[model samples]
Target chain A: MQQMNQILRRIPVWAVYLIGALPAPWLFYQGLTGGLGVNPIEALEHRYGELALQLLIGVLALSPLRRFLGLNLLKFRRALGVLTFTYVTLHLLVWLVLDVQVPSQIWADIVKRPYITVGMAAFALMLPLAVTSNNLSVRKLGPRWRSLQRLVFPAAILGGLHYVILAKGFQVEPLVYLSAIVVLLMLRMPISGVLTRTRQADST
Target chain B: GVGLAGMAQGAAAQETLEPNTWEEITSYNNFYEFGTGKDDPAKYAGALTTEPWSVKIDGLVDNPGDYDFKDIMSEMTVEERIYRFRCVEAWSMVIPWNGFELADLLNMAGVQEGAKFVAFETALIPDEMPGVRYPILEWPYREGLRLDEAMHPLTIMATGIYDRPIPNQNGAPLRLVVPWKYGFKSIKSIVRITVTDVEPPTSWNMSNPREYGFYSNVNPNVNHPRWSQASEREIGGGLFAKRIPTLMFNGYEKEVAGLYEGMDLSQYY
Candidate 1:
């Protein structure tokens, strides 16, 4: 366990980027080869959305995993954040270019449909975090950088909410993911002060 | 036309309908009685016993009894009718169905006076159907059509596809095929048919009346509240293919337009 943690700590962020990129080629191969059964466009959109949500949840879970379990995955959190944004952007593009296929209708759907509205809101929230997720911004902004990054929590919540609303009828899977995010947020509230102290120590 | 006359017209029917493969039809389906997933029906519907099927015809009809499957087949003349099947989800497919007109089946039972509507019921085998385990919809999926609509030549009781018996997942033995209305209106695996003076309560309308109406005619103008009805994707029309504009009454407007001439479709819908 100690050796594993040491390896995780020492691992390059580029490795994370490479590992995160593995699914894209596989998905593209499936899409091009007609492996995505029946409706490949819909399948691609759903998968990218799911991957984005999963990575967002992973980003939310990082602090709790480090604080409680004495295991740290903090170094890769920025990479995870950027990868989540990449997936979300891909998901949106697929919906725009492949599924709806009309600029006017796409704008109408984003504005009119509650599910799309929430999903777009979630994607919009992730934008600032993705932009400022760098060492230069961290050094320049200092304490404000952490505050700006807190958007991840709301982004995660909205992402989960988007999934819940998109489901046709009563579905348990999205609810389960939403509940997990809620619990993670609740777990986060009590240790907020401790989080600041740990961060200060890391910077020193 | 009956028997050999209907069989001889198969070539003419093939010309109008764009053919879909049996693989495409079998794989992609929405039989919610089995499950909500598109592929769920095929995986779980093998448990359904289709051979010993009997449909109970009741209500205002003169002949009210459990009609055997074999008897129903022997009495009616089956024909291949190529139809455009549109779902409420805004996806569609062209299917070549083999069955007799639903009016012929009603005529066999002798439609009594004052029968305004024809109500149909799906088989309620809780053991065979996983979806029945949930209250996502009321058990024994029910759908109905106006007597005039039911008697239309386009309304058929499908038993076969591509010269073979329909797979259990695709509503085997007997299923209603109303080409003009949304696909769900054509209730699958029908176990009961009732003629009534009043409109029957359909499953989707009862589940959520706002989104789903009793008369789910395909209209591009009237949106589905959540999604646009302006266009639809054909199932076998390729992954990246553009969605074509949806037609009024799914292109059967000429045949069915006269039925609802006096009534307000927007209000009724």
Candidate 2:
């Protein structure tokens, strides 16, 4: 585990960001070249959204990995979160400019559709977290910065819910994503309580 | 002279009808019996055996029997129909379907006095259709229409697209095509068609009554629960193509509006 952490530390965070951002252009190019099948707009939109969800799941998995397995990926969390937001933005753009394309309908969907409403809310929650994901804000806000970053918990849940509600029929894929997010959040709970109790015992 | 004038008008209309390519028509499909994904049917439906197919025509009809595909094709007058195909998911396509009027087939069986609705069902081969094995939707995908809607000239039992026999993915052998309604109403790979008084249980409507209504006519004013139906993305339109405003009854308001003259479309939708 120590060796693995050492290896992960050597890998630059910018490399993570670059690797994560690669799919966006590649997917767009695929859509342009007709490689995304018949309905490229829908395919591209779904792919971007799914990638965002996968990245969100990765972000959620980080704390649990460090807590249980002691495999610290804390260095890359910001990069992962930023990349997740980037994919989410791309997903929204694909829907707005390519998929939906109408000005009024775009606003109407965000207001009207429950799934879209949830998705936009999730995106809105990420805004401040994304803005403050820097060294200056981390130093200025101190402990409060950690509390603000915890908004990702609800944001991730909402993201999963958005997918679950958006799917046609009772699809298992969306349910699987939602369940994974819930489980990851649950895993963060008991270990923290145990650590607190252990520290109190040591003080006594 | 009137017939000649009508034929001339039809030819003029045909000139405006831009049918999607054979590849587009075949590849992009919503046959949930094959699978839910747009390309799932194209990937998996090749295993389906459509040859020597038969349609079991039953319920309130004078003659009820399993009619062979060859016999039905031989009996009917096949013609080309170019239609605006609209899906409930807010996608549109122009398709050139080759088939005969559904009314001709229904009439051949001799509709009984009690027959008020026409219910259709798709073939459910579990071994061949990998999708049916999972309960994505109630298997043997079902759909129905009012007797009048069934009798409409625009409603057809399509066998071919682009003048060739339909590929398995696009509902091979036989399929329903009701141009005015959402594409799900046009059930694919039909196996049974029943003439009955009661409104039949449609697969999507049965799955979610709030979202999918039985009378799923194309209405721009009526929004789907998840998305706005006011506009549609044209299927063949590339990534940068603009969305077009969806038309009332999918631009067949002139032909089909009379069928729902007094009824509320939004409520029905």
Model 2: residues with Cα > 4 Å off, grouped in runs: A191-204, B1-11
By summed lDDT, the worst window of 10 consecutive residues in model 1 chain B runs over B1-10
The CAPRI class of candidate 1 is acceptable
**What TM-score, over all chains together, does every model reach?**
0.90, 0.95
Question: What is the model-wide C-alpha lDDT for candidate 1?
Answer: 0.86
Writing each residue's lDDT as its tens digit, candidate 2 over A1-204 gives 999999999999899999999999999999999999889999999999999999999999998888767799999999999999999999998888888777877888899899999999999999999999899999999999999999999999999999999888777789999999999998888777698568668879
Off by over 4 Å in 1: A1-4, A10-12, A191-204, B1-14
List iRMS (one decimal) for every candidate.
1.7, 1.1
What TM-score quantifies how close candidate 2 is to the native fold?
Answer: 0.95
Candidate 1's displacement at residue B85, Å, is 1.3
Per-residue lDDT of A146 in model 2: 96
Best lDDT goes to which candidate?
2
Q: Which ten residues in a row have the lowest lDDT in candidate 2 chain B?
A: B1-10
DockQ of 1: 0.47
